[model samples]
Target: MSFEFVGKFLPYFNDGLIITLMISACVVLIGTLLGTLIALAKLSKIHVLRWLANIYIEIFRGTPMLVQIMIGFQLLGKIPLPEFQLGILTEDLSRLVPGIIVLSMNSGAYVAEIVRGGINAVPKGQTEAAYSLGIRPTATMFKVILPQAIRNILPALGNEFVTIIKDSSLLATIGVMELYNGAQTTSSTTYQSLSPWLLVAVYYFVVTFITSRLINLLEKKLGKGYTK
Candidate 1:
């Protein structure tokens, strides 16, 4: 409400923003890579691989991400594996690993569907032509199919990026100290819930708005290449 309150809460929220961005960046990279593999598997000639990929996508996509985060956090920490015993994955930083995994798995499910659709949208003639020219199946997929599929799917992936940015706020529920968590903490300590929450909303708006605009520009740029 007051400018003083706004100024006071900005610092904490800003720190939270950094964490949110870090998580989002990792999620996008991991999700996109895993999702592409899942999509390819779903399209495979082999039945078993296709079944397994479908099961993964359906389970993750069908469930709530919040539940997945909680379960993953608990399950990953209790694996009793070598990595768990290693210094690299102490209990203090363990939660973050699961958080990233949960986010990646959730995002991967959606991305898999997007990729599958994009690949399907590519013309069959393109693959046939590539084959006629003596291109290997793998080469045809990587060079010709995926390239165009990426173009078609870029906008959708941008939308997913934006969605993940906002969704990162949900990590606050697990004490990840993202924007929402920071605001919650500040509100509790300062008893200025109204101002802290409003400010967090503004921060979300600004980041998502800028990202959406950038995505629009990228779409136009990619579209130009396709049209030509």
Candidate 2:
């Protein structure tokens, strides 16, 4: 039999796309914040904090995100156990929240290292110079160290966004209807393999490519002033 996608199903894919973008945006935002903190902790002077940060980074960065998602949901199930109702942990939480949590946690680990390296790469003289001006440690970090580090980390952070976008596909396992899942449902109904997925791939490529181009433009702008 011939295949076709009805306009009604169009909404499914569209809504799926929206959910995908939403999840990606949330993951990126949460990931960046947590990642920045992790990066700072990794660079901390205290041994225990640095060691724990390193382990967190290693475990997440070293393992696949899919594994993290699975383990997170499972652990969520066992959390607080029967002893504590801990109604805070519910089944619905496993469906979408866990995806976000896992994505952010995993992405944060990698982004942390990137951020740490970026901060370290900033000249030590800059930090000392800021301190010489009587700037507080926090002020120096934000105004001097972090500003320069962000300039260096922009490209890598952009890559992290792209990775989060792609990793969202794993959400389907938990009933999150993202692009890949949308395409799968459509293909199942239409019985046509490549056409549905080809369109899906194009959508992904277009979104990622446009974002990448923007990143390049920002990189150039930032690099120019820094080079001066």
Specify the highest-TM-score model's number: 1
Clashes of 1: 0
Question: Could you give candidate 2's per-residue lDDT for residues 1-228 as a string of tens digits?
Answer: 222674545665666677778889999999999999988888888899899998998899789778888888776644442221112112234467777888899989988988998999999999999999999988998888998998889999999898788789898786666777878888887787777787778778887898899999989888884661
Clashing pairs in 1: none
TM-score of 1: 0.91
lDDT of 1: 0.84
**C-alpha local distance difference test of each model:** 0.84, 0.80
Reference-based TM-score of each model: 0.91, 0.88
> Tens-digit lDDT track for model 1 on 53-135?
99999999899989998999788855543322221112234566778889999999999999999999998999999999999
Model 1: residues >4 Å from true position, as ranges? 78-92
User: What TM-score does candidate 2 reach?
Assistant: 0.88
lDDT of 1 at 169: 80
